[model samples]
Structure formats: structure tokens, C-alpha cells
Target: MNATAALHLIQAPVALCLDDEINIDLSATDPDGDELVYELTTPLHGANDIDPTAITPPPFTTIVWETGYSETYPIDSEPLFK
Candidate 1:
């Protein structure tokens, strides 16, 4: 059988303050009742080309964010996103 994991009852604040701390919940369930483990890692850069005729094929390459910008702090925000 294929591995299947699903998330339910996700919680998030409707509003976030600029001066706030990081909080997260990764609770999830598997129909097969397999134990779940969550870890944070940099995501892969699937495609970066603009208006390309074709998308790149695997093996996909890693990407880096510009200075002061990242997958988290992608845009300018009050007090910064970090």
C-alpha cells in the first residue's frame, strides 16, 4: 500500500502580532495508524523559470533566498518575520 498521511484540526491564530513568538502544531493522523513524526527542513526549489516552455526534471536543485529574505521572511514585515 502507498504511504498516506493526513492533517486535521489544524490551529492557527486569526491575527498575529508583529512582536510575537513562533508557535506551531504538526499533529496529523494516518489511516493505517502509523506513528507520525514531523521535522522542519528547507523545501526544494521545484521551478524558478518565468514563462518557460517546460519545467525542469528531477533531480531538482536547492535554492537560496536573497539576503534578508527567505522561505519564512519572504516579504518585508513589521519587526521582521524571524
Candidate 2:
């Protein structure tokens, strides 16, 4: 279980009303030839929802893990709050 896998965002400015999809790419060859599996240890939120005091913005961390694995990316919607 390595934690060096880099996570990226495919889309930005995710909306608060709609659910978003995120991709996690984890294609790598280990020296010991270990099969790699990607799992989200923690929740990733959009820039808007990060700060709670910002007038209750829409949900920004709804990640739907797809099949397969290398670089983890996120699909963001439009911003609900200002």
C-alpha cells in the first residue's frame, strides 16, 4: 500500500446540486510485482466547500470511484454559492 500516488482533477468548479465523478489512475509496476489497487482513504472536497463559514456552499466531495487504477482525477461542477 503506497501513498505516493498523485491525484488529479479532470474537471473543475463542480456544482453543488449535481453529483460528480472522480477518476483514480494507479497504473504502476512495483519491483516486487505487486498488483496495485486504488482506494480513497479520505474525502476530497472542492475549493468552495472547504471553508464551512462560506455561507453553506453545495457539496463538493462526492467522488464516485470508477473501475481500474494510476492517476486519480475529479469531475467538478459549477459553484452553487458565491
Superposed on all Cα atoms, the candidates' RMSDs to the truth, in angstroms, are 6.0, 12.6
The parts of candidate 1 lying over 4 Å away from their true place are 1-3, 13-17, 47-55, 65-82
Error of 2 at 20 (Å): 15
Residue 28 CA displacement from its true place in model 1, Å: 0.1
Model 1 / residue 7 / CA error / Å: 0.6
Point out where model 2 deviates above 4 Å. Answer: 1-25, 44-82
Using TM-score as the measure, the top candidate is 1
The candidate maximizing lDDT is 1
| lDDT of candidate 1 over 1-82, digit per residue (tens) | 8578988776788888886664556677898889888654556676446754557689977677779766666667566645
RMSD of 2: 12.6
lDDT of 2 by residue, 1-82 (tens): 6545433434444453446544344355555555667564435544355676554366656444565421343333344211
In order, the Cα lDDT scores of the candidates are 0.69, 0.46
Q: Which whole-number lDDT from 0 to 100 does residue 57 have in model 1? A: 84
User: What TM-scores do the predictions have?
Assistant: 0.47, 0.23
